[model samples]
Target: MKQSEFIPLTLITGFLGSGKTTIIKNLLQREELSKTAVIINEFGEIGLDHHFIETSDEDLVELSTGCLCCVMRGDLQEAIARLLTKREGGWSFDRIILETTGMADPAPIIQSLVLDKISAPKVILDRVLVTVDSVTGLKSISEFEECSRQVAFADILLLTKTDLVESVEGSLEKELMHINNNAEIFKSDFGIIDLELVLGEYKRQTIAFTENEIDKHSHSHSHSHSDIMSVSLYFKKPIHAVALTLFLELLAEVLGSDLIRLKGFVYIKEAPETPAVVHGVQHIFHPIEWHQSWPYERKETQLVLIGRNISLPWVRAILETIEEEVEETTRQNEN
Candidate 1:
């Protein structure tokens, strides 16, 4: 087996009191996260969150200097680079996780890694996990842009405090789906979630359209707030690779900031055995990865898009049109 050259870095971000630290505390106790270097940003002089995390001194690094998004960003980079140095000096760590301040927006922090020339090559961003306080989550999204943006950029969203709430289905849930349709929402009682779900490789599970169908997934809803909504598209047939690329390009050009995150596995006609994995943040998309084999016998293309101020009807129409165009061209060439 080929060992991965870069260390995987995960980001934990959410609004104030949204249980970001609570999730980290739970993750530290798991053996899966052991030998993981944790970098935490402290808002004040004392790093209270760090104290709560039970890890060795070598594995824990606290940035009590300043907020990671602002003046302390340089220090954050230095801390990560130092961790790399420690690894060379006989320290053993497989992964790194960073906890951001609740009020902070995650874009800048992500850019810090993407734009860094030196440290960028050493670490690969694995995933971003955002926690939402069920009690105050809706209120925070309504009142604060930071909270909304945090949700927008998340790969996985943990809805904490579900036990305290009378019902999980409400305006808050509707609003969350509107703002970020792409994130997989899981309910957590008190920061207790299976480590596998949190740290495992992302695999999209699709629901069948008909009861008799082998597999499928679907959701439809209307929200009072119109800024964000998740759009899910499932193709019963395999899609052409070029058509899929064009669709993503058009989306990035048109949606821009309105496009929060896009992720899903696609079955391509060109490669029947391997599924093309696609993911993008805003307009910037990461390179596609191809899985060796299908997760199951099902061979269909699936795409889930989370965007702001976009219509599902328009998205669906555009994609259908693109696939049609590709098929027509292929037919003409074959003739």
Candidate 2:
């Protein structure tokens, strides 16, 4: 509606070892997505996924500890909304890839956007990409709710790790149909699929739905809910890098378990031109990535954490530290 067109979100989800990360990495390789912003969410810790991406824009972010559906749901919508508004020269990506935690219920995140009018400012559910590990296929169906949720909500299904098991594209197709008759399932090994096939799948589904159908679909599914929570905190002013870094270290060291993921767009005093953005999953933390320019309507620092048993009060004071409130900071320039 505004200057920015409807933001397209490509939700990538599936069970552990499903090659969801692998396929998304391939999608990043596509020339079409060279400008895409990727949110990579992992469980427990260790963020190796960001290292695998070869892009130079610093467009990749790894979310750890928290699941997107449980805690960062509203934050996700806000982040997208902020992205649409954050621009001195009209910054917009080709797409936004949201990689969910392997052990997650995708519905909460999906429903959050559909139900939350704020996220509807300039964004819509572009498509769902679910990767299934053919080796551990049927067993996951009976064992994990996360597995079923991934398949049931998908618009396009990618069958991965097929090389380990017998070639069962036909059987896998049948299994996918049983759970989600609407999605198109394809076979993949080592995440090797033609970029054409991947993007083409989304384009076809895009063509199938009229604009009115999307409004109806979003309205129809907006009433669902879950127990897990996503939370976002804001500061009147940006904080110094040293204080924020110390705060993050304490978060990972102390409240690591309750925290599934922590992502923030912070304003560091030393670097005033472009703000600092940090993505940390559980114990493993990626050093803050600085943006070349601010991309939204607000200059205030914002932090999003997704998890369980987390008390926003614990670090509320620390996160709210305005750059002016804190002492001088050593310049940590963007790479």
Candidate 3:
């Protein structure tokens, strides 16, 4: 909230055509992002998104960090310093959004932001927003380590193309829960999600590996990149938010070693429609945080998994039992 503190930046990443372009294009229209700057990396020779962007104020700058996972540190640090210079020169820049190339990996890009250079640190990583196609998320996860990593490392996982993925939603939902029980997953059609969800000036903190955060929900599920990776499960409605949090803590604890990342937007029996998101690294899990409001047209409990070998039956049972216990507790409270 302090204006003098450095702004929080979000890394937007996903596979090619996962609607990263579409999302960014619409995002620029948001009045909240008027002073927000964009640092986009293009893998191909010609940058297609540039044509769609109409930035007369010069807030949008293009910086190509060739092979995001490789030279991300150097390129990002230089770009941040350049941005500071530009701002000092009269053009003021507020927040930053780094749109990584489709094939990019998000971990190093996120890890690098917190680090200092010759001049200073590049920037603070407020959160990571990942765009995933409702249709191809599973396939992408099965084939690419980057896809899995992108989802795993995200603070917010935005599910794009949900209308085009009604059939696969069930499967994707299951996989999402097994991998990450903590992340808030928003399903968007036509690349629609509130800018508040995408853009935030939240203070950046490293993923903490405290015993309480990782001691519960302990399990491991991993798959080689070549395997088919997706799962879905159902739970009886109305679970206490506290129990759900406990389940996630346990889930992160068990899967922490093997988990690349975990995320979901759940409707607790206590707070329906208002979703909470969870983000975790390998063995390090952050606490669940509530969203300001629902961004999507609909609200339902849905979790998206990006890891492999995450079991359907085990996760399903775990979630169901957690809810059952929580519901019983709620019933007793009312009595």
Candidate 4:
């Protein structure tokens, strides 16, 4: 199906008290976003965030199962499916927004969207918007691994509570950039932002880096926070399709939950003209998306793996070995 045919789902996440609910509440009041269906996942027994949103009860579904990143992934999928089913039954909604508990990791929740056969076909991951408290954002990133991961996976970083602070500290912005250079940062006063920026056309950013560059980037940003890190791999040579599958399988088997997020475009030997877009969280991956043509001037494989304790050298070595073996096998078959 065409990308536009799928219902876009935006994920809102942040550290506790970062004002995710405030943002959702404000956005829902907008004329353009009034038709949005919101799914609020709260950690404890009582789910108060949904009540605060003020949306119609039918449009708001609260999940009190557990932390979305841990136990309630299935429930999240089911909720989306239910919402989509309602849409089919004359309930009108163009988009879906899932607000995860502040303490949630977000990776597993993402995995559910990427891997679920049911919801994956109907809904597309529009963007990951993470809210960070301007006053306490730096401390949260330093103290909590969950906060760090939220920042790392974010497509847009919303710095909330800016009015309370005299000035948004440069250190907080610097720390956020250090963790995730790709995310676009914006100052959100009382959770209000231009709707166009939040619900805009999705653009996939390419993260290409050599091993040396990854090492340098890591060393420079090592002092900021948690053990979570990122490694980028750029391969000029087109990899065999079989080799790409093997490479991802090996990574999933080896890294498991430690592999937080992996996304990039691969130049496949079989179809050199079209790039295969890969997105994965831990062991689960979205089906490879084949773009009509390369989105870059240069066509090459550029993959960024974000995780904890992942070795760049090991990942590269595994890919090279798998590619070589696959190439040799193909050559013999031809002979």
Candidate 5:
């Protein structure tokens, strides 16, 4: 399909009380979203009327019957079709944003767009933006599968209600990164954030890691929640391609579902000029993105893996073995 013909559709999802509506309410007030149509799907009896979005004949839509990911799946596709038809009929909009129910899983919604014959042509899946409430997120992730899946599938993770907390102390941030390393984390207050940050060029959305953030997490945190934990590894030297490849392959084979997500920037010895951006969900690894240059001052490898019932020491040992083999091979070649 031609890029010009495809309309970008972004998914705004989160667990219960993660502030999805609050963020969309603020976004609709922006000029950038003036041409955007919205589909709000809520579970149970909650309504969108509280958001105060100015409802016109065609601008807003709501679906309430269980969750869009399950019961309302057909309604979601129909809503997209209806909105597109409205655009063709003269009520114009450049894009669409679907705000999913707090209890919904977004994977099926995403699958519908990719598999559906009609909607697939008209709409393009743009981004998955998930909001996690900073105050109550830890308990939520530990207690809920829906919450973790929301985090795992997001392209960007926005932390809301940050004002309610004294300091995030990099604790929440670390947990989020482990859940989905591919997503760049951002903090929000009252769900207010720049529209440009949300709708801007996503390729340049790498989070700038500061020395303080690195220092704060110099030592890993102890987790009482054994089901979910994140292991962060850093390498000062560029990794050999063979070693990196072997490490990823072995993990994907052994860990599989236990490995929820893997995302990081790796400086490849083969391509020192350009760094490799890796993204993996479960066992499936997407094509590695090679950035033209490092996005931050720290030109080192940083990987955060979020998994359930995974051993950090075993993971570390595998990586150490790979690096040693690479070094040994390098010395042999030199001699």
Candidate 6:
């Protein structure tokens, strides 16, 4: 199916009391997001986040069974499947926003979107927006592993509660950068920020990485804030498509959940003119999206993996070995 035909879904997540609901409530009020369907997954039996959101009943779905990530493979997939079915039945909505519980880990939720046979075909993951409390975000990241993971997996980091705090500490921003340098950070007052900045299509441009930056973060070391880290990889040569598949399969088999998120553009020898967009969570990967053309002048393979206890050198070595073996086999067949 064409990319435009798929519905874009954004994930809104944060630690408890980090203003995730506030951001959703505010976004729903905006005219640009009026036709958006919301799925609010709150912890415990009685859900309250959905009640706070004042959208049409038909557009709102509440999952109060438990944490979203825990039951995401089943309940979350069903919720999205139902929403897609409703849209087919004349429900008017162009996008979907899932607000996960504060305690939820985003990896499984992302996996559901990538792996679910039913919903994966219809919905595309647009972005992951994680709200961080300007006042308590630092503490949350330090204390709660879930909060740190949320920050690590974010595509856009929203620093909420800025209005309440005297001033957001540089330390908090630094800490966030330490966890995920690729995420775009924005300061929000009362959950108000330029919606276009967060929802813009231009933000989908392939991430660029420098050799030095990759070298700096390549080491496997422990951070005081959290063990979660990001590794940027840049490869000049085009990779065989078969080799890419082998690399991903090996990663899922070996790392599993420790591989939180992986996104990048691959330069495939089979389609060297257009870069292949790769996105994955845990063991599941979205079907490769082949762009019409390279977004930038320099066409190469660039990948950023976010997770815990992941070594950059090991990942790089794995890809190099797989591609080398695949190339050798191809040469043998030709000869």
Best lDDT goes to which candidate?
4
lDDT of 5 by residue, 1-335 (tens): 58778888888899888888888888888887888888888777777533566646468888866688887778888888888777778988888888888888766787676555786446866778999999999889888988888887787888999888888647677777655555778889988977865688766233334435533543454563225555566677887888888889989889877777676788788998798887665666656879898876767877767777666568778887988898899999999
Candidate lDDT (C-alpha), each: 0.77, 0.64, 0.65, 0.85, 0.76, 0.84
What TM-score does model 5 achieve against the real structure? Answer: 0.70
RMSD of each: 4.1, 17.2, 10.2, 2.6, 5.0, 2.6
lDDT of 3 by residue, 107-156 (tens): 66765664453433235567778888888888887777677667666667
Q: Quote model 1's TM-score.
A: 0.80
- Pairs clashing within candidate 4: none
How many clashes does the backbone of model 6 have? 0
- Candidate 6 Cα errors over 4 Å, as ranges: 2-4, 84-89, 119-121, 206-209, 214-223
Candidate order by lDDT, decreasing, is 4, 6, 1, 5, 3, 2
lDDT tens per residue, model 2, 211-290: 35433533443332221223455554656777777778777777755555555577776787787876544444455678
lDDT of 4 at 252: 85
Candidate 1 whole-model C-alpha lDDT, 0 to 1: 0.77
295: Cα error in model 1, Å: 3.5
Q: After superposing candidate 2, which stretches have Cα over 4 Å from the reference?
A: 2-4, 85-91, 119-121, 169-171, 196-198, 201-335
**lDDT for each residue of candidate 1 in 158-243, tens digit (9 for 90 to 100):** 89988888877577766775566556778888888878665798555432123222111123344334455566666667779999
Candidate 6 on 1-335: residue-level lDDT in tens? 78767888999899999998988898888999888999999899988888888988999989998998886558887888888789878998998999999998988888777665666447877888999999999889999999999998888899999999898998788778767767888999978878875468845543534667545543422355777777777788899999999999998889878888888889999999988989877667788889888877888888888887788789889999999999999999999
Q: Evaluate residue 305 in candidate 5 and report its C-alpha lDDT on the 0 to 100 scale.
A: 73
lDDT of 3 at 161: 89
Question: Which portions of model 1 show Cα errors greater than 4 Å?
Answer: 4-6, 30-32, 43-48, 54-56, 64-77, 108-122, 162-171, 199-226, 296-298, 324-335
